[model samples]
Target: MGYDVDCDKMKDECGVFGIWALGQSEEAANFTYLGLHALQHRGQESAGIVSTDGETLYVHRAMGLVADIFDAGVLAKLKGGAAVGHVRYSTTGGSHVKNAQPLAVQYAGGPIAVAHNGNLVNAEALRSELEAAGSIFTASTDTEVVVHLLARAHPAAAPGTVEHLVGSVRQALGRVSGAYSMLFLTPKAIVGARDPMGFRPLVLGRLKGNWVLASETTALDLIEAEYVREVEPGELVVLDASGLRSERLFPDRPPAPRLGRCVFEHIYFARPDSVLFGRSVYEVRQAFGTQLAKEHPVEADVVIPVPDSGVPAAIGFAETAGIPFAMGLVRSHYIGRTFIEPQQSIRHFGVKLKLNAVRGLLKGKRVVVVDDSVVRGTTSRKIVKMIRAAGATEVHLRISSPPTAWPCYYGIDTPTRQELIASTHSTAEIATYVTADSLGYLSLDGLYAAIGAERTGFCDACFSGQYLLEFPRRQNHAPLRLVGG
Candidate 1:
C-alpha cells in the first residue's frame, strides 16, 4: 500500500556523509539532510543520522527516504555541531531499522558511531571470532563486527580521547579485510578512512569554515561547499573543532595492490553530475556509448535509449555513429522504481509500468536501444519485446558496459554467476533470449579506453571475473581474508 524503493539495475550498497565544525555556526543536522538528499540516488531503503554536541549523542534511523525519516522538529532535537549520516542499500544484511547505520555503540570510549559505504569480504570470519570471544550482536550487519572489534582493541581502562579513539579503530580496521570508506564519529572528532585498495569513493570538502566528508562531490555541491580532495587510499582523516588532520591506516600494509578501484561507479552507480575516480561520470558514460557504436555498428532508422540511465550513452552513440536520436521509449517519471500494477490486463506488465514504447515514432522504424548494462537479461528482453510489439521493424540492443558475467564482492550487490545471463549463455544465445535482432556489449578493453585508464588499474571484477580479495572460492562465499595479515 505504501511506496518502496526497489531498483532492477545493479545497485551500490550505500552512501555516507559527515559534517564537523569548531567555532563555526553551521547546523550540522540540517546540512547533513541536504547532503543526503543530493545522494538519494545512491540508496533509498533506509536513512539515518547521529549528532553530537561535544557531550551527548543523538541518533535517528528508519526505513525510507531521507525526507520520510526526518523533519524540522527531529533535526532541531538533534542539536549538535557535528554529525554523521548514511543512506543504505543493503549489501551484507537484510533491510531493517536494526541494520541501518551510523550504527552507534557504547564502549569503553563512551558512545561512538560508524557510517560505512562498503562490504567486508571477511565479515563472516570476524563475526565468528567475535562470537567465540563472547561478544553479542544485535544487528545482522558487517558494521556491527567493527563495533565489537573496536571494543576489544581499545584499552578497557582508559577514557576515550580523539587520538585514542581513532588509534583504536585504526588498529581494528587493520585486522579486518574488505572495501570500506568509513566515518568514525566520537564526541571529540570524526575520523574518516578508506580501504587500502580504494574500492569506494569518499571526498573532503569545506563549507564556511565547517569541515565535511561525503561519498561524492555532488553532495558537497548541493550545500555550496568548496571541494577539497579525495580521502586517499589507505589514509585516515581526522576532523575536529581544531580542524582536520591525517594519518595512514595501511603503512605496513598488503602487497601494494597495483590498483583496485570500482569501475561500475562510472558505468551506473554514481550520479552523472558526480566526479569520481578522476573523471566525470557523465563523460565516462558518454564514452561508453561512443565505444559501443564503434564496436557494434548497425544500420537503423533511429537510436533510442532505454529511458533515463541510457540517455547519455545513447546520445553519444547517435552522434558518433551518425544516426538520428529520438525518444522512442518514454519513461514514466512518476513511477518510483517500484509500483503495484494497476491491473493485470496491462501487457508486458512490470516493464510497461516503468517504460512504454512511443508507437508513433517506433512504428516501421529499425531502432537501436542502448542501455547501461545487462544484468539478468530480463529487463532487456522485455524492452526488446515491447519495441517489437510497438511495430518496430527490427530491435537491436546495445549495452554500454561489458556483459556482467561475474558477481561483485567489494561493494556492489550482484546476482550469482548462475543467475547472470552472460555467465550461463553465449552472446548469440543471449540475443536470442532477449528476442533482439542483434546484440552487442562493449569489450573490457573498450571500457578502459572509455574511462582513459589502464585495465589493470581498476576493479572490473563483475565483468572480467578477476576479483581483488583472496578468499575461499566457494558457492556464494568468497571466504573472508584478514585485513591485518
Candidate 2:
C-alpha cells in the first residue's frame, strides 16, 4: 500500500519503536509487534524487529506488511528483554528486503541494531566517504551509513559498557546531519535520539515498570502504555536496568530560533486518533475545517468529506457553514495492491476500485467535497467526475491544507516540484483542470491559526518553500548492485 500506483496521496516516512523490559524477555517481542501494528499506517512496504537477550541478539525482517510478516512462530524466535522495530516506506533507498530495518550488525565492539524513522540529508556524502575508506555496505538505505559510522567510532570506555555504547552512538550521529528520530538497541540498553531541528517525532512512555519509545503517541496507546514525554530535539535518552537518563546531543550550538517540526504531521500524515507535537490530531484537523470554512464560505446544499482523512475537516466545515454534513462518498478499506483491469474500456476504474459515490446523498445537490490535499490532481479530477456522474448539480472542492508546491527532503516521499499541479497553475487553473465548480485551499495563515501555534516552530517547506536545511542537488550515480550480506 505504500507505493500505490494509482494513488496520489503523499507517501509516508518510516516508523520506529523500541522497548526496554527488564526481566521480561518473553514479552518484549510481543509488545514490539503490537507497537509496530499500531504504526502500520506510517509505512507498509517492509517491517522488522531486532531483540536482545543479555548476551545475544535475534532478528527477523521482511518486505511486507507488519501483520503479514510477523506471526506466533516468528515472534517466538526473537527472544530478548529489550527490542527495536521498524516499518519502512523507503524514502532514500530501494524497496528490497536488504533495506528493511532495525538494521542489525556485528561490529568490533559487539552487536547493535538500529531502527530509523527519518531521512539523512548527508547520506550520499557519508556513504561515499565510508566506501572510499574500505567500508562495504550491504543495504542501499541511508540507515546503513549510520551503522558503519558506529562501527568505526572510537569509544573511550571499555568495549561492552553502557558508556562505550553511548559514546559510540554520539560520535556516529555527530558526523551525520538531517532529520532523524532513531532508536538504537545495544545489549546493555535501548537508546533514542532526535535531530537537532526536531524534524520528526519520538516519544517516551512506560508500561508496568518497563520503558518504551515510539514515533508517535498512538503506538503507546495501542500497547496500553502510559504516555510520558517527547524525546526532545537535540536530546538523547538511554533506558537501561537503572531506568531512563537523558543527554543533549548538541550542547555547544546556540538554540535554534525555532524548532523545525514537520507541519504535515498535523495536516495529513498522522492518524486522527494520535497526538503529535503536543496537539490532539483530531481536534487540530477539525480546527482546520473550521478555519477553511471561514476562509472559503460556499453556498452548498450539503458538505461531504472525500472519505477517511477528510471526515473531521468536513464535519467542522459543515457545522461552521450551517450546512448538513453527510457521507456522500464511501471508501473501500479492503482494496488490495493489485487487481485486474478491463482492457482500455474503463476510465477512472482505479479510483472507482477504492471509492463509490452515494447516489442518493449526492443527487441534485450542490455538494462540497473536502480533502486533505491535492497531489498530482489526477485523483481529484477523477473524483470530481465521479461525483458529477452521481448527479451532483454543483461540486465545490475545498482543501484542508495549503497547496504542496515543493517536495519534502526530510522524510516524506513526494513528486518533484514540476509534477505538482499547484507549483505552476493558479487556483482557478487547477479548478478548471479538476473540473470542479470551484476550488479553495486553506491559507497558510489560517493553517497556523488552526494549529494554535506560531509559524516559527514548524517546517512548512512543502507549503512555503522554506527548508530548514540545505540539501545537495540530485546527482546521477550508477546502479549499486547488492554487495555483501
Model 2: lDDT to the true structure = 0.90
For model 2, where is the 10-residue window of minimal lDDT? 476-485
Q: Which candidate number has the best TM-score?
A: 2
lDDT of each residue in 1-485, candidate 1, tens digit only: 33232334797679999999744653888999999998888888899999888887899999999998999989998877899999998899998999998999888778998999999989999899899989999999999998888888754336668877876877789878878999989888999999888889999999988899999999999999999899888889999867989878866756445668889998888899999988998999999999999999999999999878898899999999999999999988766656665665653476776789999999999999999998888888889998999999999999999999888878788887788889879999999999999999999999999999997667888887777777546666443333322
lDDT string for model 2 (1-485, tens) is 13253468899899999999957656788999999999988898899999988788899999889999999999999997889999999899998999999999988779999999999989999999999999999999999999999999998998888888888988999898789999998889988999988999999999988899999899999989999999898899999989999999766666556689999999888889988999999999999999999999999999999888899999999999999999999999888655666564664487888889999999999999999999899999999999999999999999999998888889999888888888889999999999999999999999999999998888888887777787677743212222111
Give candidate 1's error at residue 11 in angstroms. 2.2
Off by over 4 Å in 1: 1-8, 155-158, 341-348, 476-485
Could you tell me the lDDT of residue 483 within candidate 1?
30
Candidate 2: list runs displaced more than 4 Å.
Answer: 1-6, 342-347, 475-485
TM-score of each: 0.95, 0.96
Range of the 10 consecutive residues with the lowest summed lDDT in candidate 1 = 476-485
Q: In model 1, which residue pairs have backbone atoms overlapping below 3 Å?
A: none
